[model samples]
Target: MGMRLYAIVIYLFLYLPIGIIVLFSFNAGRHASDFHGFSVKWYGKVLSNPFAMDALTTSVTVAFITALLASVFGTMAALGLQQFKGRFRALFDAAIYIAIMIPGIVIGIATLIALVTAFGYLNPALAAAWPEWLGDAPRLKMGRVSLIAAHTMFTMALVIVIVRARLAGMDRTLIEASADLYATPMGTFWQVTLPQIFPAVLAGFLLSFTFSFDDFIIAFFVAGSETTLPIYVFSSIRRGVTPEINAIGTMVLAVSLSLLIVAQVMLRRRDRPAA
Candidate 1:
């Protein structure tokens, strides 16, 4: 009974703020401190706000591309690591964890500097090589492309971890059987390996999408002129919080929680024993 009470207290402590945000999202009052009444005006306000809409669109686009790229490349990476043996593999595994554990600000700064330096050199080289149309073309500096790359850099580590966990628990006999049947590497992967680990891939994709969508620190550094949803929200806060902001927060929380719940359900189902 004591433990149950403690667990209840912990859950309330964790979710109380979220509950307040959701509850007050519908509050007719503009002031966050008071709830004058219940209304959906705030939702309409959020929908009608051009800045919010544009930011939402940009965030969705980035998250979609990030998820797709992370899923494909991360799965490939997991497969490579699974087959690898030796000290290098151990080093690589440690590196993935380090990337995951690193602060977002550090990653953002490092990514920004690296991209700027690379583009600085590459732009000059390209201009020299092609003095015509290519020379005058705007060189890649920092913007959506850089933001996507930064997101992929960290999120890919998460994907690799998820897919690798799945791979580690997979049956090797099935792969051996495919090899015995004279299946090509590609054929075996498509037929035998992919289906087995697809749940983890899907989970990774969902997680990547969520991370990219809600990310603010890295996106702020690398976004250039583009404004993602999180960055927009942060900018809006300087002007003071309104019901519209609350509504947006509620919506973001809903989407993130929904994705997380779905991912958890998928993973649980994958782990369940078949009768």
Candidate 2:
């Protein structure tokens, strides 16, 4: 009975706030504070906010870029280090840990500085050759690109960790068997090794995507003028919580949660054996 009550207490503590927010999302009033008769007047407000929509678009673009870059780099790094053991291998592991375990503020500041410094260090030829879309210096200091880069930097270590674990779980016999079949290194990797890891790579992509989407701290520091959903919500709170905010929050919560669930379900199906 005590344990049951304890479990119940924990559940309420964790989910009660979510329940309140969700219940109040359809609120007729702007803030959840005073109960107005239930209606979705606020949900319509979320759609009508032009600034909010721009912020949302910018955030989504940045996060998409971040997820793509992180997945490619993380998966490649994991694959390269998978069959290795030695001093450098251990060093790489420690680096991954440091990347994640460091304070977010510190990382954000470092990233912001690095962006400026890197722009300075680029050769004139390199800078000239750079695509027109790639902004220079402090322009890099803020905006969609900055937010994406910040999120990617913060979430990269986690991606490496997940992909590495999945690789470690992979069957070594298949790799050996491919080699024994006289398949060339590149061919074996493409044909035999990659298929086994596709699910893991996909999982990492979704994980990184979700993290990049929801991040607030690094976004607060490195995000120039554009606001992500979390940042938007935070800023809105200063003006006092309105039902419009809750409506946006409810939509964000719905979309994010749905993606997560669908990703998990797909992963599970991928893992299961065919009859």
| Off by more than 4 A, model 1 | 133-135
* lDDT values, one for every candidate: 0.91, 0.78
Residues 61-143, model 1: lDDT tens digits: 99999999999999999999876889999899888988899999999898989889999999888777775854475677799
Cα displacement (angstroms), candidate 1, residue 122, comes to: 3.0
User: Which residue pairs show backbone clashes in model 2?
Assistant: 30-242, 30-243, 31-243
| Model 1 weakest lDDT span, ten residues long | 266-275
Model 1: colliding residue pairs: none
State the lDDT of candidate 2 residue by residue for 1-275, as single tens digits. 99999999999999898888888987776557777888977777788898778778866777789888888888888888867799999998898888889988888888778876775566565767778787862323456776776777656777788777767767788889989999999999899777877776777777788888788888887886677877888999998877777777777788778878866865674466422
Angstrom error at residue 272, model 2: 6.8
